[model samples]
Target chain A: MTATKPYHHGELRPALVAAANAIIRESGIEKLSMRRLADQVGVSRTAPYHHFKDKNALLCAIAEMGFEEQNQMTREILDDPEDNNNEAVFARWVRAYIRFAHENPETYDLMFGREIWKGGTPTPSLQAISKTSFRLWVDLVAKMQQRGVLPGSHSALRTAQASWAALHGMARLLIDGIYVQREDLEEIAETVVDLLTRTTPDSH
Target chain B: MTATKPYHHGELRPALVAAANAIIRESGIEKLSMRRLADQVGVSRTAPYHHFKDKNALLCAIAEMGFEEQNQMTREILDDPEDNNNEAVFARWVRAYIRFAHENPETYDLMFGREIWKGGTPTPSLQAISKTSFRLWVDLVAKMQQRGVLPGSHSALRTAQASWAALHGMARLLIDGIYVQREDLEEIAETVVDLLTRTTPDSH
Candidate 1:
C-alpha cells in the first residue's frame, strides 16, 4: 500500500493484454470479457475500449502474442549451435514445439483454433504475424532438407505443410484429450521425428 | 404431410438419432437439444428422455454413429480390389479420408473434438467403438507395411500413430479453416503418400 501507482494510459495496452491472457489461461476463452479484463487490471470499463475496439481486438492481441512467442522459439532453435547433427536438432525442435503446446494449451488453441481464425475476424496485424511465423517454419524445413534432415524429394512448402500438420495434429490430440496421453509424448515425438526425417533406426 | 405416419414408440430411438443428425448438419452441434429434437420429430419433449438420458448421451450416440460410418469407410477402402498397387491405394485412402473430414466437418469434430471426449464423458459403447475404429486403422497400417506400401522399419503402432497424426492434422487444419485449402488436397495428399512411403519421385 505504500506505493500504488496510478495506471498510465500508455501502460494500459500491455496491462490489458497481459490481464486478458491471464483471464483466458485461468478460465476458458469463453469466460473472457472486456469489462472483466478491465476490472481485473484496475481500470475503468471504458479504458480498455480506448485500447481495443472490442473483445475480438483483445483476442487478436492475444493470438498475436502467441505467434510472436512461437516465432521466437523457432528462431532460437534455428540459432542453436550446440548440435551439429541436424537430425537430433530437428527432434529436439519437435519435442520443444509439443512441449510449448502442452504448457500453453489455451493460448495454443487461441492461436490455431477456430476461435479467432474461423469464428471471429483476425486483425490484419494478426494475419501478417501468423503468416510470417509460418514462413519461418517453411524456411526451416527447406534448410533441414538441404542438410538431409528431411527428404528433399518434395517441395519445402509441401513437406512443411505435411510434417507441420503431423506436429499440429499431435499437439491438438494432446490438447483435446483424445487417445494421446501426456506421458506418451516423448515416444510419440520420437516416432514423429523418425517418420519425418525418413530415418530407419531399426535398420541401423 | 398427407402420408405422414405416426412414429411408433418402438421406433423412437432411431428416429431421435436421425433427427439429431439432421439438426446438427443443418445448424451445428450447439443448436441441438432434447426438447428441440422431440419437437422436430413430433414427439413429446419427455419422449427424447426415454431414448437419451441427457444431452451428453445423445451426443455420444451421434459420435457413435460417426465412428460406425468412419469404420465402414475404412473397411471399404481396405476391401477395395480395384487397386492392387498398395501405394496407389494408400494415396486413394488418404484422399478419401480428407474428403470425409471435409464433407462431415461437424460430425468429424464431434467424433474427435473435445466436445464428447474431453468436455463430456464418452459412453462406454462410444469408447469401445472408437477404439475398434482405431484398431482397424492400425491394422491397415501394419498391412501396408508388410506389403511395402509404407516403410516396414517401424512398428505398426508407431507408424500408424505418426502417419495418422499427419492425416488428422491435415484434416483438422482444413476443417478448422486454417492455411490449408480444400482445392489443394490432392497434391498435398500425394506428397503425404510419398513422405510416408519414403518414395522419392524426384529420383526418377
Candidate 2:
C-alpha cells in the first residue's frame, strides 16, 4: 500500500507497460498476467485492470510500442543521406528490420504472432498502428518500383507482399530459433536482397 | 482399469498419436494433455506415459506425421506425369504447399511452431524427417537451376533457402490468419512462381 501511493496517477499506465515489457523480456510472454504485472509494478491488483481490459489489451499496447519504435527506425534509415543508392538504402532497412526482431524476440512475437492476429481480435488502435507500418513498406515498395530498383512487372502491392513475406519469414525463422545460426543472418539477408533486386537495371 | 487391458501393446503408439492429432485439430494445441488424451482414448493415464515422454515428445510425433504427409504430397505432385514442365510442376507444388498449411492450421502450427524448434530440442526422429523434407526441396531447387528454371547465378543451397523462406513466410501468414484473403491465394502463388522463375528459359 505504501509503495502504491508514491506513483502519480499519470505514471501508472506507463509504469505498468514498462513492467510488463520487462517481465516478457526476462521471462516469456506466457508467464505474464494482470495480477502478476500489478504486483511487479507495485500497484493494487485491480489497478492494471483500469488501464488494460485484459492480457490481450496489454499485449496490444506493448505491440503498439514496438511498431512505433520500428517505424521510427525505418524512417531514420530512409532519411539518412549517407546511403544515397536505392539498393544500399533498402538493404540497410532489411538488415535493420532483422536486427530489431533478433534483439527483441518476445516483443517481435507480440507484434506478429498468432496471439493477437489469429482471431482478428487485436485492439482497434493496435490494428491501425500495424496498418500504418505496413503502409510505409508498401509506399517504399512503390518508390523502389518507380526508381527501377524493384521489378516493375508486378503491381507494387504484390511486390511489397512478396518481399515483405521473405523478410518476415527469415525473421521468424531466426527469432523462433528454427534457423539457429546467428552468423548466417547477414549472408541470408544479402541473398534475399539479391533475389529481390536481381532484375534491376543497376544490378546488370 | 478394464479399458487399459483391451489394447495390445503394439497398437498403442499409433493410437496415441491419432488421438493427439484429433485433439489438436478439434481444439487448439494448448488444450491437449496426456491425461485428457488418455481419458479420451479410454486408456489408463500411464498408457500415454509409455508412448510419449511428455507433451513435447507427443508434439514432435504429431509434427513428424505432418512432415510425412507433406512430403508425400510433394512427391505425388512431382511424380505426376500430367505436368512434366518444370515450371508448371513447381508452381503446382507451391500452391499445394500453401493449401495444405491453410487447410491444416493446427497441424501446420505444430510442424513449424516454436514449441518444437525454439530450444533445439526437437526429437531426433522429428529432426531427421524435417531434414528429409528440406532435402527434397533443395533437390528440386537444384533440378530447376540445371534446367534454367531458377537463377544459376546463386548457388542451389542459397536459392533454396531464399525460396523456401518466401514460401514458409506466406504459409505462416495464411495459416495464422494474418493474411486472410482466401480468394487471393492463387494469385499470390502465381506471383511467387513468377518471381522465382522469372529468369527461366520458358518464362522468357
Candidate 3:
C-alpha cells in the first residue's frame, strides 16, 4: 500500500495570520474573509475555521500581534540606557508610538479601531493581551510620576489613560490622514510631550 | 391627457443624506449601499445616484453635515458669555468636543476616519467644510494663546494641533470603545483640561 501524505500545512496558524495581514495591508480589513484568506494561503476553506473560529477571531489574533509588537518596542525604549533622562525617554516613547501607527496603519486600526472594540467582538484572548498591555502602560506612568516626568497629583491609572489618549489621538489623526501634513509630526509630538510632562503647581 | 405626477422627490438630497445616516448608524458605513439606501428611502435606485455620484459622495455629504453640526456647537460654546474664564472656556470646549463625538460615533468616524481621508476620497465640498472647521479650531487656539489660556511659548498652530490632537485622541478613544469605562469620561476630561492649560514657566 502507498504511504498516505500528511494533510497539515507546516504552520497553518501563523501562515493564515500572515496572509490575512498582507490582505488587510493591500486592501483593507473589510476585504478579508475566511474563505478568501484560506484560498490565498492555499488551504482548504474549513482549514482556517479550525484555527480561528471566525473572522473576528482571526482579527483578534492579528491585533494581539500588534499589541505584542508595540509592547516590545515600548520595552526597548524604556530599557535604553542612552536616553535615561525622563523628558527624552518620554518624547522618544511618544514618537515611537506614533511611528508604529504611521508605519502599520492597517494593523494599528485593528488594534485600537472601532472594528473590534466598538463592535464588541474582541476575543477572550485579545482582551487578555490588551489588558496586560494597558497595565504595562499604567505601570510606566507610575514610574514616570515617581521620576517627576509626569504629574503625580493624579492617580497612575488616570494619568496613563489621559496621556495615552493624547498619543493615541495623534496616532489616529496621522493614520487617518486627518492631520494632512506629515511634516507636522515632529512639532506635534514635541508639543504633546511638553503638555504631558509640564510640572503643575499642585504636583510640585 | 391627465397631468403626470412629479417624479422628483421634493427634498431628495436631504432625505437621501438622512436615510444614509440612519443606515450607517444601524449597520455601519460598509453595509450602506446606494441601492439599499434608495430602497429604504422609497425612491428609485437611480434617484440616489443623481443626488450623490456614489457611496463615497454620500459619505462625504454625511460627514459634511457632521462638520457643520460640530462647528455650530463649537461656535455656541465659544460665544457663550456664561463661561468667561480661560480654564472654564477651554474645559467646556473640550467637553463639548468629546460629547459631540460620543453622541455621533458613526458620523464622527466618517468625518475623521481613514475610510474617507486615507482613501483620498473626500469630496471638494467635504474638504471645504472640514478646512473651515479646522481653521476655526486654529483661530480658537490663537485666541486662547492671546488670552493666556494656552502656552505662548509654542506657535499657535503647533499648540492648536497638539491640544486638538489630545482632545481628538480622547474623543476617538471614547467613540471607539477602546477606553472602556464610560464613567471615567468626566475625570479624564478634567485631567486633559488641566494638562492643556497648566501654567508654563514661559507663560508665567
Candidate 4:
C-alpha cells in the first residue's frame, strides 16, 4: 500500500500506462516499446507483457484513456445545468473539442489515426469506449437540435457525423501540420460553431 | 521521343515519378525509395538521384501531381457553364473531392498527411501547387456563396476553411479507418451537403 511502490501488483498497470504516455510525450509513439517501457517503469521485462500483450495493446490503452477523457469532457458539457443555453454550451463544446485534440495530438492521433483503426487491431475495450464517445456526441447533437442550437433539418446521427467530421478535420489539419495553423485554432473552432449553428440560407 | 524507351534521355524524371507511384500503390509509401524507383524504372540507381534529391523529393512530386489533378478537376467543374446552377456544381465538387481522396488514398495521405507537410520538407513546387489547390477551393466557395449555394453570412475564406475542413475530415475519417465506413460515403457526403447548404434554423 506504499504510495511510492513503482511495481506493486495493482499499481503496475497504471504506472505502465503513465510511463508509456511520458515516453510517447518525450519522444514519439514509435519510441515507446514494451521492452523499453518495462525498463522505464522499473519492472521486469515480462511485467508489461502481463498488462499489454504487445505495443498495439498498449497503444489501445492510451487511446482508451483519450476516449474516456473525451467522453468525460462531453459529459461535463452536456450535464452542466448552470449553462442551460444550448448555444453557449455548444460553443464551449466546440472549443473544448479542438483544444483537447490540439493539446493531446499524439493521443488524439492514436484514438482516431490509422495506427489503431487501420494499421493495428483496436482492443475491444478501446472500441467500446470509442463507440461510447461517439454515441455521447450524437446524443449531444440531438439535444442541441431540439433547442435550436443546431439545425433540425438532419437527423441526430447525420448531424453528429457531419459536425464531428468538421471538428475532426480542423483538429487533424492542425495536428498533422496541414493547412490549419495552431494560432488559427480558435478562429476555426468559432467558424465551425457558427457554420453548424447557422440556418441554411435555403431554409430562410 | 520514343514512348517505348523506358529510360530515354529526358524521360527519366517522368519515368521515375510514374514508377514511384506504382511502387507506393503496390506496396505502401514506406516501401518507396529513390533507388528502388530507379530500379523499377529500369535505370541506374543514381538516375533517380539526378532528378530527385531524395525520397522526399519524389514524394513531393507525387503530391504535386495530386494537387494538379485536384486543381484541374476544380477548373473543369467551375468552367462548366452548361450547368450554371451553383447547388449542382457544389454537390459535384464535394463528391469529387471525397472520391479523389478515396481512389488515391496514398497520394492523398502524402499530400495532406504528416509525411510531407510535417515530417518531410515540402519542395517549393509542392508548396506552390498545394496553395494553388486551396486557393481554387476558396474561390469556388466564394462563387457558391455569390450564387446562394453556400451561406452568405460567413466570409469566403472562413466558409471555405470550415467547409473544406468538413470535407477533409470526412475523407480522413474514411481514409484513416476511423468511424466512417466506405459504404457510407454517399450518405455522409449528402448529409454534409445538406448540413452546409441548409439555412441555419435560427435564421428563420
Candidate 5:
C-alpha cells in the first residue's frame, strides 16, 4: 500500500470517482475489486464505503462521470456559437456520439448495454444525470427543425432517434472491429455528418 | 425429463434455436446454461456439445440463426413488390428492422452488442451471413437514388449509414430496456419509416 493520504482531500467524492475511472480504464470493470481499490487509495478497506454504499453505487457514480463528460462534449459541439445551423447541429451531434462511443467503449457499454437506467425508471442520481445528456441531443434537433432547416413534422423526435441509431450503429461496428482499424475517425464522422445534413429540408 | 422425440424432426436446428430463444426470452443470456438447454431438448447433457462445442459455440450458432432469420425478414420487407418505390423501399427496410429488434431481442443483442461474439471475433459463418445484410441496406439506398425517387447524390452510402445509425440506436435502446419502453413502438416505427422515406440526396 502507498503512504497515507489525509482524509478530506479537498473533495473525496470526485477524487474517488476519478480513481475508480482510472482503474476501469486500465483493468476493465470486470477486474475492479473493492478491496484492491481501497488499498490503492491508501485508505482503510472500509473508507470507500463512506463514499459509496457498495460496488454498484460506485459503478453508478463512475458511469455518471462518463455520461457528464459525454454530454458536455456533445453540447460543446452541437451548441457551438458559430455552427448553430441545422445541418451543422445534426452532423456535429452525430460526430460527437461516434467519438464518445469509440473513446469510452467500456463506459459506453456500462451506460447503455447495462441498462443501469431503465426507461421511465430513472431513480439513481447517475442514471438521471445520464438521461439528461440525451436531452441535449433532443433539444439540438428541435432547434434545427424550428428553424426550418429540417423537414418532418416530428423532426425533433424522429431525427434525434435516427441520429442515435446512426451513431450507435457506427460505434458498434467500430468496437466490433468492423471497417478495420483507422487512425482518422474523422473520415467516418464526416461521412455520417454529410449524410444527415443532406437529409435536411434544403436537400430537396 | 420428457421422453425422447424422433431425431428426424426435420427442423432440428430451427427447433433448437427456438427453444434457446425461449430460454433467453424468459431469462437472459446469462442464464442460458448448456446442460439446461440439453435438458430442454430431452437429450443427454453431452448432446449439445455435438452441435456446439461449448456455451460460447451455442451462442454463436444461435446468433447465426438469428442473422439468417433477420436476412429473410429484411428481404421480404425490402422486396415487397407492391412497395418497390424509393419511399417504400426505405420504409419497408426500416420497418423490418424495427420488427426484428422487437420480436427477437436476444438475437438482436447478440448480433449488435459485439460482446457475445466470443473473444471479439464472430464465427466465420456468422460473419459471412450477416455481412450480406449490410450490402442489402447499401444496395437498396443506391437503387432508390438511381431510380430518381430519392434525390441527391451518394444516397446509397449516406442513407445506408444514417438509416443504420437510427435503426441500430433504437434497437439497442429497446434491447437494453432503456429507449422505447413507454412509447408505442409501432407508432415510433412509423415515424422512423417516414423520416427515412423523405429524399435527402445530399444526406448520403
Candidate 6:
C-alpha cells in the first residue's frame, strides 16, 4: 500500500495474519512473532511492520477478523427462518458460538481472554463487531422473555447476561480441551437453551 | 540435583517454574522463552534446561499448580459450615469458582483453557476435582428431586449441567470483562442461585 511494498508481496497483511493463525494452530499464540510470521508468509520484515506497527496490532486485526466471522455465525443462526421457536433459535446461536471458538481458538482467545483493551479501549473496529454479537444475544433473550418463553419476575436482563457466560464457558472449556467429549456437548447445549427459556414458579 | 546444580541456584527447577509463571502473568504465555525467563530470574542459560526440558514442561507445571489451587478453592467452599444445606452449598461453590476465575485469570486459563490435556491421552488429572464439583450440583439436584422440590425425571441431570454452565458462564464472562460492574456480580450470583434452586417448577 505504500513505498514499503515489496514486488511479490502485494497482500502481505492478510498473508501474515493467515500465517500467524497457522503457527497458532501448530503451536499456540505464544510462539507467533512478526519476524517468524513474515518469514513464513514469504514477505519482508518491513511489510508486516507497515501493516501492523507491532504484534499487538496484528493480534488486534486477527481479532477483528474473528469478530466478523462471529457476527456472520450469529446472523446465520438468528436470521434463519427455520428456527420455529425461541428454544431452536437460541440453540442454533450457541452452536455457532461453540463452533467459532473450536475452529478459531487463537482469535477467540484474543477477543475474550486478553486485556487488549487495557488502555480503557479495545480496538474500536473489533469492539463494535463484538458488541453487535452481544446485542444479538440481548435482543434475542428479551424477545424470548416477551413471548413468555423466559420467566418474567426473575429479571430477564440477568438471564441474558448469565446466558452469555454459560455458553461462553462451555464453548471455551470445550475448545480448550477441558471438556473433550463431543459426546455430551449437544445434550449440555440443549439443556442450556431450555434452562434459559423454561418457566419457573418464581416468575408467576 | 547432584549434576545440574549451578553454584548460584541450588533449586533452579522451582525457581524457573516461578519465573515462568511470572512471565505468563506479565505477558501472555506466547512470549515466554527459556532464555528470557532465565535472564529475568538472574540464572545462567543452561540452568533452565536442567530444570525444564522445554517451555512446555514449565507451562504444564504451572497449569498443574492451578489445578491444585482450584481444588483448594472448591474444597474450602464445600466444607464451609454454613454451606451444609443443598442451596447454600451449591451457591458457595459457584461463588468460589467464579472468584477463582476472577482472581486468577491466567491460572484458570492455563488449568482449564490451554491445550485440552496435552499429549492426547486426555490424562485429565484435573478431572476428578471437576467431577467432584459437578457431583456437588448433581447431588443437590438429586436431593431436590428426592424432597419433591423438583422433577425426578432425567431432566434433573440436564438441569444440573445447565445450572453449572450458567454459574460458570457468568463467572467466566465477568472475569473476561463481559460484566463490567463488579457490584452487580454478587446480586446476580444470588439471583441465579435462588431462581434455579428455590423456584422449582415441580413444586407447583
TM values, all candidates: 0.85, 0.89, 0.91, 0.87, 0.79, 0.78
Q: Rank the candidates by DockQ, best first.
A: 3, 4, 2, 1, 6, 5
* TM-score, second chain, candidate 3: 0.90
User: Which 10 residues in a row give candidate 5 chain A its minimum summed lDDT?
Assistant: A114-123
Superior candidate under TM-score, 1 versus 2: 2
Chain B TM-score, candidates in order = 0.88, 0.88, 0.90, 0.90, 0.78, 0.71
**Model with the higher lDDT, candidate 1 or 3:** 3
Question: For each candidate, what is the lDDT?
Answer: 0.81, 0.81, 0.84, 0.83, 0.66, 0.67
Note the chain A TM-score of all models in turn: 0.89, 0.90, 0.89, 0.90, 0.76, 0.82
Residue pair clashes in candidate 3: A169-B169
The positional error of residue B129 in candidate 4, measured at the CA in angstroms, is: 1.1
Evaluated at residue A121, the lDDT of candidate 5 is 32
Which candidate, 4 or 5, would have the higher DockQ against the true structure?
A: 4
Tens-digit lDDT track for model 5 on A58-139?
7777677778888888778765778634455666566667777778876876676543542223337865786687777778
Ranking by lDDT: 3, 4, 1, 2, 6, 5
Task: Return the TM-score for candidate 1, rounded to 2 decimals.
Answer: 0.85
lDDT (tens digit, per residue) of candidate 2 on B38-146: 8888788888878778778889988999999999997887667776676677777888889898878888888887667763369999989988898888888888888
Q: Would you give me the overall lDDT of model 5?
A: 0.66
RMSD in Å for all candidates: 4.3, 3.4, 3.2, 4.0, 4.8, 5.0
lDDT of 3 by residue, A1-204 (tens): 536635877799999999999999898877888889999988888899888887788899999999999999878876676765766777777878888998888999999987788764899888888888888888888888888889887899888989999898789778776745788887888888988898876544
**What value does the interface RMSD of model 6 take?**
3.4
Query: CA lDDT of B25 in candidate 4?
Result: 80
Share of the reference A-B contacts seen in candidate 6: 0.51
Report iRMS (Å) of candidate 3.
1.6
Once superposed on the true structure, which residue ranges of model 4 sit more than 4 Å away at CA?
A1-13, A30-50, A200-204, B1-13, B31-50, B199-204
lDDT of 4 by residue, B1-204 (tens): 656864355787887888788887887776877667777878777877778787788899899998999899999998897985656899999999999998888889888986777568999999988888889999999998877778788788888988999999999877876666778777988988887886543433
Better of 4 and 6 by lDDT: 4
The TM-score-based order of candidates, best leading, equals: 3, 2, 4, 1, 5, 6
How would you encode candidate 6's per-residue C-alpha lDDT over A37-102 as one tens digit per residue?
A: 888887666668888777777787877888777777766776777766655566667777777777
Model 4 chain A: worst 10 consecutive residues (lDDT sum)? A195-204
Superposed by TM-score, candidate 5 places the C-alpha of residue A171 at a distance from the truth, in angstroms, of: 2.7
